[model samples]
Target: MSTPANTITENPPPISTGVTPQRLSTLRRWNIGLTILHLGQAAAMLILANNFAIPVLSAYTAGRPGTIGLTTSNLFDLRIGWAIALFLGLAGLDHFLTASFGRRIYERDLTHGINRFRWLEYSISATIMVIVISMYWGIVTINALIAIAGANVAMILFGWLQEKMNPPGRTITTMLPFWFGALVGLTPWIAMAVNISLLKDENLPASLYIILIVQGVFFFCFGLNQWLQYRQVGPWRNYAFGEKTYLVLSLAAKSLLAWQIFAVSLFS
Candidate 1:
């Protein structure tokens, strides 16, 4: 019996690539393109880093603010652009290595659910981003910085667990891990917000407000990609679609953050 033309199934069969040659070829091309893009961005950022550096709190003594506990290396002096470069560079390396050697695993396409390389990269790169932003927001107390880094790392681990614990082909995605991950991720942002409100008594720069808005929106989009995938929203219903969205989000988010930061703080 033929189904009606307008009818659509609520849950379609998984679009796992099944290791087909054509699908692999397509994925290969994607990886290659992402490799070029990320590496190119990294190179450009390094060039910018050559001329610009952001002062970051490196070490501070607890006893006093001025002369009592003096130290030479109190601040980390380096271009945030360099850190952003690392973020892009790591992404490039992930793609390059996967395209060159991990062809077999690329076929997993969300059936296995977990992309370990992605979480691994996030563990370093994303954590760096959080720490950088936290410092930028004047949340530079040693304990706060450590907590921020730990929270971001935990968030990434929870993300890995989300996939590891719920391979789509083997079980219905419980989604608890995803929510837990979101909660963990929110911690750093909340800390940043609270710090800002408490610390900034005077008028804040307009650019800073813009930066906050852009960062918040892009971060939401990042989480939304995962939400859509699990909710089986259109396009996101395809795991590959969510993967592509993640790539795009990573590029856009990092680019925006890097250049905005450069323009506002580093361009001398």
Candidate 2:
């Protein structure tokens, strides 16, 4: 029965609105329905393991099913496809698990929260990309793979050194090694772009060129995001996001790129 003016003696806040957070919680609480949706997506991906059952199943992967697919055809393509499927399925499981028991994960594994998506995350992403590329390239490009391995090792070291140098305060320490690794990683894409531009012997679908360029640009975006986050620079200083938001975004972008590149390998 008491109003804001009647209750307060000094600096009273605004009057009541539509619904407070406590009232909203009662109306929109997490329950079994969200859990089921998450699990259903995970289950649906099983269709990806078998390409022959339904031609439409390939739609989940958004990939072509010509001559080979899933675990049914060429050894190289199979391995590549298998990795992509594994990543997608595991990602679905992650969402389900997070939804069902995100609090525990938040308290335990995700303690660092948003700060976790820094150099360490970039290192892990770079390692995963290298592994996938190495598997696809195989023995034919052993020397080239070795060079890539060396570059990745240097990349990790740089990331580590940069993290160590980073102090508690959000001072602008523009870690050069991070940029160095980013530039180094672009070599393969640049080579691919150049070869295609010159009409070389390499055979691949035209759409793949678009994918590759987009993927390269995506990597650059990641680096820029990291730089912005590190410095809290410019317009980025005001932006805010929770730990889970960054986790899902980082996973989705990196996984989607991996999936697409792996799918394109089948064309080669």
Candidate 1, residue 44: how far the Cα is off, in Å: 1.3
- Report lDDT per candidate: 0.74, 0.45
Q: Rate residue 227 of model 2 by lDDT.
A: 66
Cα TM-score per model: 0.81, 0.52
lDDT of 2 by residue, 105-154 (tens): 42232222122223443454454455454443332233444565566656
RMSD (Cα, Å) of model 2: 13.4
Ten residues in a row with the worst lDDT in model 2?
A: 52-61
Clashes of each: 0, 0
Q: Which candidate's TM-score is highest?
A: 1
User: How well is each residue in 170-263 modelled by candidate 1, as lDDT tens digits?
Assistant: 5566789888888988998998888887874576567776777787788778778888877778777666667767778877877787777777
- Candidate 2: where are CA atoms >4 Å away? 1-46, 49-78, 89-126, 130-140, 149-161, 170-174, 194-203, 238-249, 258-268
Backbone collision tally, model 1 = 0
